[model samples]
Target: MKFDKSELQIFANYCVAAAESMAYTLVRTAHSTFVKETEDFSCALASVDGLTFASPRTFGATWYVGLDYGPVIRSLTDYQPGDVCMTNDPYSGFVATHTPDVVMWKPVFYEGEIICFVAGHIHNTDMGGAVPASLSRTLTEIHQEGIRFPPTRIVDKGELNETLLSWMMCNVRAPEQNIGDMKAQIACLTTGERRVLEIVERFGVDAFKAGIGQLLDYSESQSRAVAKTIPDGRYFFAEYVDEDAVGGKPMRIALTLTVDDGLLQFDFSGSDPQLTSSLNVPTGGHPRHALLLVGLNYVLYSLNPEIFLNAGMLRIATCEMPVGSVLNPVEPAAVGMRSLTCVVVQAAVFGAFAQALPDRMPACPASSVCLLNVKTTDTSGRTIMASIGPVGGGAGGSSAGDGSDASGANMAFLRNTPVEINEAEVPIRIQEYGLVADSGGAGQYRGGLAIVMEFKVFAPNTLVTARNRDRTLFGSWGIKGGRAGRTSLFVRNPRTADQDILGNTDLVACQPGDVIRLEGNGGGGYGAPFRRTVEAVERDVRRGYVSRQEARERYGVVYEDGRVNAAATAALRADMAEGPVEANAFFDYGPNRSAHEAVWTRERYVALCQCLETVSVGWRFFLKHQMFDRLAERIAEGEPIDGVQIVFDLFAELKAQFPALAAQQARIKQVA
Candidate 1:
């Protein structure tokens, strides 16, 4: 069963190829535009114990490379050769994370014995809920998001579960699309079964199992090697979601990353408590939850691109997520918009790693990706649901070079649907789709440019939802004296007489002739702007990526007669170097965040967390909001504020006003 390194490498390639083939099967045969064109799906091969060993490198979403299927597999009492299990309940096994994402797995048997499993998931365009797409930050409960399925057999003993399929079809808005996509997933799993059997026949069942173990071990070793290169220390970082919901207060995600020797521990203790909105992430408090370590995956890949992609790669890291926090919410808490929260999670991890590996890490990326979905009717009045492709933001600038323009950094797997395909399939007209000039932050290496999408709907009473629209208020932070990126903007009838600016609004009712425009956030810059060569700035202006005015103001690059003025540019740079710097010399979080943080400092945040720890989960979010309102009032009244005292005083007043709250607090005290 033992094999040399060269042999292991060859076996690894084979497994990867199998996973890639499975991914292609799903993409080519899927029904919805979200799955086939956008490619918002994943496929992997796992051991019988449910630890993924191989996944596609260049296909599908990379979020599930470290997904653990053990909990769900064990929940089933029995499995047959043709049995395929499916689930979308986040609380059931914490596998799907959201209702729209349906996860499926099939037990692969070779020679009448189980050897491995083939698994994957696809994002359903619509599942029938309060909103058209079944996902919105405004949704307050999981039930509002969509109907959920627990870990159950959709296929048993090679027989289709007609009853279960009917139930699913009845609940969803687009039954045909869902059923077609499900069949494609089944076909993909069948392909995986065939390919896995081929591997087992060539290597023998025993040797195949042994090779899987060795491959996992090799991936773990590679991750540990990368970890060892990072300096040992506790790096703390915090990021904020624009708001828990539309027109709501901000929700913070804090992290304390401790790296000792070659191991890493991420403690998300100071994060905000579970919100009433769907932004909560349901992880079942698992230490190695895939959502918590998505940023770490990107970091490790950046550190060592050759590192193996498997569950073992994530084995080096562990997360400590508070039970009631946004990162690990309890059941019944809506998780429809958990993907948006994970963006902030990724940003927090990247921020922490930037401190530990300052030289290696880039500035913060535009961690916002807006998924645009349209629910409109045809001339026949039949309901139609389709995704109009994702509008992703720019990547952060790095020491190597300027960041990629209008690129999806972490969520790059969700490919953009072509304009021709979208217009043909959906009732919409694509007016403009291109990058915005002067949108990226200025630095020695400028950040990537943001995207601008303008589309007009053709039907009356059409519903559209732009999920995960963020970074409008607080832009991506720039590091090493660089400037923050541009903020996002959403407008209806933009540049017209009736232009309505919709900030962070996910759902909207559109009439015919309504032109909706979405301008996404840009990536943060790296290093100082004045340090950038004038030639580079001029080139950006020439390419229309940066405007001449912005180049002069932000980068101190002067232009005269459509050419760079070397003498004047040097003078401008000299004057710009003496400008007043922000409070944090290392990070430029833009004026909006800087103004917000000026009041809500670290000490106040610590005090807020300490006070929230005393309250029960049900009372935590309410009490925190009340305390924040009181703090703001005190600030406006021109009184010196003490965060701890303010929170305590507010809690005392609230308890006295509400007898039920006082009784609950007494009961909690008695229990403690």
Candidate 2:
């Protein structure tokens, strides 16, 4: 049953149609906002070996197109025809990136033979935890996060595991909604099984099996072809999460991508160790998790959008993550807030590729999704908790054009809940929802505008949780001389004289008439603002994206009478273009990263990484923490000091503080 080119393509399209049909069923039937509206659920058909063969293009999460089903499928002893195994624990199996995402898998059987597996996972709103949404950036361990279902049968051989399902639902705040969404996933998986069976019956089992295998191979070939276009070399970049939520220190995600002859090796061995916060990502050490979707999305998407996004692309690369690192944390480590970290992961990806594909990749984006939770008891005495709406993360500006505003450049699958839906489901009133003016970073191609939302709590004693909120301390970096995007903030009672500027918080209790304002960060800009055409500058000024004065100051384009002042614009450009340039003309890391790099110079940063390489991975995080603590202490003293000298001194202090572990880390100090 060897497939020729034409036959293989036709067969591939058929499988894709089946996958889309499955996802359509779920999207149509789901009750949770995360699934029905946000479209965070995904349905796929997998080969017997557990690699995804067909993924829906028109629906569900496109970022998880490369997820593997083999590990979890193999964890069980055996599965009957209608048996469905479910898991959300990242460490227990390769089922999900976090606990809130419940994954279910079923085997498709035809003619008394197993043909393929049908799998689907959706972001369940609540799963029983310390918080209503089961996601907390401050929560230190998974034990406090939620109920973890680790590869257990929720439906046994066509019979509903009612006892197990009901018991599980009783644990979450949104029991009815959670159960309904869980059933939606099961229904979609069952639909996938039915669709695959129909395809097998029509084409015959042998041809169907061959086609599924061929699909992955075809996708791999296309991915490899794209990989070849990237010059073979090592590209290095690092980015930080704004803060640990509980602590003020930033977290690092360092990556050195080695591209060689159409093969990509992502070396994250230099990343920081696991943290005591939910920000840790429980990736199960899988290279193709949602966080790593940056490389897959940027490269394959830019090159060929029609290629099958299956496990085939996974064959072209390997990821090297050190054990116990934040990306691959150990058991009991909180993983509720993985998406915020995903933002930094993309920064490292863009920063690295900016080195290799300067003209291709845009600057860093203020691209982290946020959740706003409201918890309170209804009049009937039943507790209610739900996410009010999805946070809008503006996309980074690109050479092709300005990034999409508010909707997001990444995680495009998660749609914002409608105002009507939020009002009806939760006890709150939406006061305002719109794009922030002058928030987008300025460049030849400007970044997208930030979204601002205000909500008034009408219910008494309402506890609100807005975890993983960031970018207030640091702005999104721009590239090619573009200025950084503006930062975000949490304002309380903005219209009143008692308006308080609240930065970021995990949770805050509120009463009736209390207002909360969330301003999402803008995406990074691309190219220099001054290099932008005067016409574009005038257009931005008119559109409220840039003010007339900002246009004159930032882009050197003086605007008057609703248009660019030609003579003044010419004079200003002449003055600016010839003036002394402070940074490189190629990349703009924004002021914060640039200032930090001045002291933590790339040379020093890399040297620090090398020095820690001598110590055990477990102790590296504490040592790094000590270094940052001492550096901050010195900086806070208001004494002008060199950052590089501070790092050297910090190492000496560490050596003296931990003499027993000096043998592990002092070698680095001695070498430096």
Write down the TM-score of every candidate. Answer: 0.98, 0.94
lDDT of each: 0.89, 0.79
Worst-scoring 10-residue span by lDDT in model 1: 641-650
Candidate 2: stretches off by over 4 Å: 287-290, 378-382, 561-563, 610-620, 636-648, 658-672
Q: How well does candidate 1 score on lDDT at residue 354?
A: 95
Clashes of each: 0, 0
Please, what are the lDDT tens digits per residue for candidate 2 over residues 1-672?
Answer: 878988888888888898898888898888877788778778888888788887888887766677788888899977788899889887777467688888888888887788889887888878888877888776878888888878889999888889888777888888888888888788888788888878887888899988888888988898899889888899888887777656557777898989898988888876777877888877777776645655556567766777777888778878778767888888877888887787677778777877887788776667665677788766676677777766765778888888778866765446788899888887788999888877888888888888888999877888888866877767777888787888888888888997877776767788888899999888888987888888887777777778887888888988677666799889998998898776476666667767776666666676677656677656766777777777777778887766466666677778788887787566655875
Residue 551, candidate 2: Cα error in Å is 1.6
Give the 10-residue window scoring lowest on summed lDDT in candidate 2.
289-298
